[model samples]
Target: MQKEIQIAQLITALQKGDVTAFDQLYFEYAPLLYNRIFKLIKSPEIVEEILQEVFLKVWNMRAQLEVDRGLKTLLCRIADNLAIDHFRKASRDRALQEELWTSSVGFYLHTEESIFDKEKQRILNEAIQLLSPKRKEILTLCNIENKSYKEVASMLGISANTVSNLLVSAMKDIKNYIHSKYEGA
Candidate 1:
């Protein structure tokens, strides 16, 4: 059951410059929001910025609020959407570097198709294990499942550019891992 006097109400009070309410709201929700942002973005600095922005947004929009449910879901959605936006923007910034190295990028053709599904699965597992969960999620959502960038972004609650960035990073890591493991074997 949901509490009648919810944290959103506390947030509304905080938005009105109620210091005690703000402190109460922070104590209640900040840690959960922080971890949610951190797991996705993986940067304390960026997470701090996102956390501040989230509170600011809540405060700025508090006047128009209506809550028929628990504050947890609403707050989680806001933090998640915002963190995805931040990471997506950062990912786009990193893409210029990839474009510069485009000429240096090479594609390899596999001549040996003799490996059975079991062996292929083993190598694939190793590759997946080498990735951080975020990267693995990016690949699973976009590549293996054949979702469009926008689709993956929506599913992950981020921007298309962020999806692109995560996909790029994940691919690079997987390629390097596979090479080091199978190059001379």
Candidate 2:
């Protein structure tokens, strides 16, 4: 259902810093993002900030953007991530925060929380960074924050259905990204 050619054109335009292209995509997608996001945060103040951050991140990374999968999905993934980060930073000092983190992240702890493990940490960070924002957020929430999908969706104002859909897509992308890099003998 995605307009593939239009999206590819938009991605190309966005990469060139085309204002019209940016405005076109932003106007079209920001509402869906805001609605999906505000359902959880419910704060116009933080929601606006995170929304801006999501678009900005998209523009910043536009050079690397690919639309074979549709730009809307990528934007959705970005929105999902910023929402999680907003929640993480917001609850950084809450009493039950660790419990929340553990539930959201996987058992991905290395020797320490520090990326000082150099090679290993770099590879790990690359993998994390390559994840569609949704997967990274899901991994963050379930493993790092220890949150359940129910809780994560509640915080983001999204249905568990949406969260599950995005998480599944993210996991598949991560697997493919990692597999392509590691598969060669």
Tens-digit lDDT track of model 1 for 38-154: 998888998999999887776777666555555678778899999879878878878977865663453211223334555677887898888999889989877788999999888
Worst 10 residues of 1 by lDDT: 106-115
Per-candidate TM-score against the hidden true structure: 0.47, 0.48
lDDT string for model 2 (109-180, tens) is 643444446744565668789887767887788668888889989988888888788777776776776676
- Could you tell me how far off, in angstroms, the CA of residue 135 lies in candidate 1 after the best superposition? 69
Instruction: Report RMSD (Å) for each prediction in the order shown.
Output: 27.9, 33.3
TM-score of 1: 0.47
In candidate 2, clashing pairs total 24
